[model samples]
Target: MYRLFAGIEIPREIGEELQAISKKVTGASWRPIENYHITLRFMGEVDRNTAEDLDHELSLIEAKQMQLTLSGAGWFGSSEPTALWASVEADEDLTRLAERCDRAAKRVGLSLDKRKFRPHVTLAYCKGTPLQEAAAFAEKYGFLKLGPFWADRFHLYSSWSGKGPSRYVSEAEYPLT
Candidate 1:
């Protein structure tokens, strides 16, 4: 089985900007610069046949290239604060692209994600970090604003989760023209 997802890739400059503010929180496993992206769909695990079908379906998606902005900062898990994220703000183009990905997932016989599409690049995965520490980090650097950058393509990516930094390899590229 392969752990898969569909997402938009971040430019190297934007990744470097995110890397700058990734400090000041303990127990928050900061994601590597190369791992940054706005995930469109998260398909946890699937066998080879399903993966192929999903890939083919995703390739058929039609979307126009869009500009996205990394604006503000936030965290999930509220009091527990499970993650720190850099939010993405953009036109309906982003949502429409995500919807195409959703349709692709469903067309391949995968269950559609119930969560509403909220575009953001996860900056770090928190583990046992106190709410105070997380809050302070957000308070200090939450005003981060980066890019109204062009997103020309999305990808079918394979995720590798291990002890060190998470690894995501782009297995297929889908262009938006």
Candidate 2:
């Protein structure tokens, strides 16, 4: 089975900016620069046939480019936060793209997480991190106000997590006009 997901890659410039602001949080395991992406859907583990089906369905998705902005920083989980993430504003184009991915996955008989799509690029994974400290750090950064980057493509990424930090490899690229 292949562990996979579909997401938009963050530009190098924006990743650098996010990396700069990721420090000073105690007990936080920061994500590597290459791992920064706005996940459209997490497809989890699937067999080769299912992956191929998803690839075919995804490639058929035709949508226009989206003006994406990386904005704000925050942590999920109320007490003892589990992750610190950079928020993404989901405009209509982004929403449509995500929906198309979701529909494709569903059509291919892949079960998806039922959570509402809250777009974010995870900055770090936290272990027993104090809520106040994380909250303070988030408040300090508040709104990130980064570029309105143009997203003309998204990818099918395979993750390898056995090592120190999870490594994401792009298995397929699907472009939008």
Candidate 3:
């Protein structure tokens, strides 16, 4: 089985800027710069054959390239924060791209994701972190402006869950034209 997702890659300079914002936040595991991406769909575990099917379908997606801008910072989970992320405002091109990815996954027999699509590049995952600390961290770097980058492609990525830094390997690339 393989764990998978589709995401837009972050350029080196933007990743470096995000890396700089990470600091002494207790119980938060800061994601490595290389792992930074704007996830479009999270298609959990699937068998190798199913993964192949999904990849083939995703490659056929025909959409225009998206213009993305990274602005603001926030954390998910209120009382006990679970993640800190840099937000990307929703735009028509981005929304359409996400929807196409969703359609591709569903056509491959993957279950639908119930949650609405909210685009963000996760900075860290907080485990048992205090609420006040999380709130303060959000406030400190709330005005993060990083891009007006063009996303001409997205990738299908594979990852494993365990200790140490999480690394995502791109399994396939799908160009948007």
Candidate 4:
């Protein structure tokens, strides 16, 4: 079985800017810069044949390249904090791309996410951290303008993490024409 997901690849300069924000925000758990990505669809562990079929189906998605900008910050989970994330400003192209990915996944018998798609790059996963601290950290560095970039391609990634940083390896890339 393989754990897979589709996500946009962030450029190095933007990743560096996010890393700087991570350093400034104290008391909150920070996700490593290498793991920074905006997930489009997550398809959990599946058999090898299903994975191949998913890739073949995803290859047909043709979205026009769009510009994406990192604009704000937010948190996930209530009660006990679960994550800190950098939010993306909503754009038609981003939403359409995500919807196309969803449609592709559904065509291959994968379940579509019931929740509305909200795009963001997870900055941290909080474990027993105070919510107030996390919120404050977000407020302090949330206004960061990481500029913008053209998203020209998306990837089908294989996720792997044991004890250290989570690693995502791209198995296939689909270009947006």
Candidate 5:
């Protein structure tokens, strides 16, 4: 079974800026620069045939080039603080593309995701990090702004989590017009 999702890659320049801002926080496993992306739909653990069907459905989605920006920094979870993430400011085009990815997953016979589409690029995975550290990071960089980077395409990404940070591989690319 392949673990997969549909997502947009962050521009290298903007990613570097995020990296710079996220440097102060410790006690978390930071995601590699290559792994940064805004997930559209996480279609977890499917057989080869199902992956193929989802790929075809994603390929059929028509999208135009759209701009995305990083508006702030925050962490997921409240008391436990499961993750630290950079917020992606929402765009209508971006949301529409995400909805299309959601539709593709449903078309491939996957169940609906209960969580609403909240756009974010995860920076680190927290393992018992102190709440105050996350709070401090939020206080310092919560209003951080990065870019209006152009997204020319989205990808079908395969994810694997084993030892360290999860590795994301781009299995297919769907270009925007």
Candidate 6:
């Protein structure tokens, strides 16, 4: 079985900007640049046949290119934190594309995500730190916009679970048509 998901790849400049901001959050564990992406769907473990079928179905989706802007910084958990993320400013094109991907995944027999989609790129996962500090940091840097870029493609990625962080590998990339 292979652990897999679908996500959008962030551009290099935006990645670098996020990387710089990540260094400011004193004790939080930052996510590596290569792992920075907004996951569209998380397709847990599956056999080779199912994976191949999912990939083929995903390739048939044709999403128009859209523009995305990283707007604010936020944390996922309330008290004991689970994640730190950069919030994406709302864009209708991005939403439509995400929904298209979600529908395509469902067509391939994967479970649909029940939660309403909110676009954000996770920057880090946190623990043992005062929540106030993280909040303050977010308040300070949240308004720093990382400009804008075109969302022209998305990818199918695979991961391997282990002792430390999971290792992710891209299986295929599907361009917006």
Per-prediction TM-score: 0.96, 0.97, 0.97, 0.94, 0.96, 0.91
lDDT of each: 0.90, 0.91, 0.92, 0.85, 0.90, 0.83
Expressed as tens digits, the lDDT of each residue in 1-177 for candidate 1 is 999999999999999999999986878999888899999989878889999999999988888988888988888886698999898985699898888888888888889799989999999999998888888877876788898899999999999988898799999999999
Error of 3 at 15 (Å): 0.3
Q: Mind giving the per-residue lDDT tens digits that candidate 2 earns over 102-121? A: 99999999876698888889
Residue 152 lDDT (model 6):
84
For every model shown, the clashing-pair count is 0, 1, 0, 0, 0, 0
Task: At residue 24, give the lDDT of candidate 3.
Answer: 91
Clashing pairs in 1: none
By lDDT: ranked, best first: 3, 2, 5, 1, 4, 6
Tens-digit per-residue lDDT, 56-134, candidate 4: 9999998899899999887887776688888888889999989988898898899878878899999887777777877
Relative to the true structure, candidate 5 reaches a TM of 0.96
User: Which run of 10 residues does model 3 get worst, by summed lDDT?
Assistant: 158-167
Error of 3 at 60 (Å): 1.1
lDDT of candidate 5 over 10-112, digit per residue (tens): 9889878878876755688888888999999999989999999999999999988998999988898889888899999979999999999999999989999
Candidate 4 Cα outliers beyond 4 Å, as residue runs: 24-28
